[model samples]
Target: MSETAMNAARMIDMLPDSDQHLAYELIKKLVLAWDPDFTKLTPEEAKLLNEAENDEFVDAEDIDWSQIGA
Candidate 1:
């Protein structure tokens, strides 16, 4: 893996379950916003992200949406 990929993996691994899911989603959004090729992710990274999406520890409802005011 490239240094960036290895760093991202290590950072993700260090996060709590909730934070890991949040980071995965944030990274996914950033990738989409930048319109990068999705295939840039290695299979292992993709698998880790997919697993994060299925994790139940992160509660969307628990987030303080008011802080993101329009």
Candidate 2:
């Protein structure tokens, strides 16, 4: 383990049970954000992203916000 990781683990070990659980949760969230799985896009997803990039967007005032529950 890296020095920083070792130090963090030592600090976490000193925490109370409740704090340890909280630390674990925060660590898990950080680890997940460190690697997102977005290598492949479904056809429908690809189409939406493509349209967003290439299409003319609706004007903010023209959108019926309630219709989309926004």
The lDDT values for all models are 0.87, 0.85
Residues 1-70, model 1: lDDT tens digits: 7799899999999999999999999988998877666556667888999999888885789988989775
Q: Best by TM-score, which number?
A: 2
**TM-score for each model:** 0.48, 0.50
Q: Candidate 1 at 30: error in angstroms?
A: 0.6
Model 2, span 1-70: residue lDDT tens: 5678899999999999999999999998876687556456656778989989898877899978889964
Q: Least lDDT summed over 10 consecutive residues: which range in candidate 2?
A: 34-43
Which residue pairs overlap in candidate 2's backbone? Answer: none
Error of 1 at 49 (Å): 26
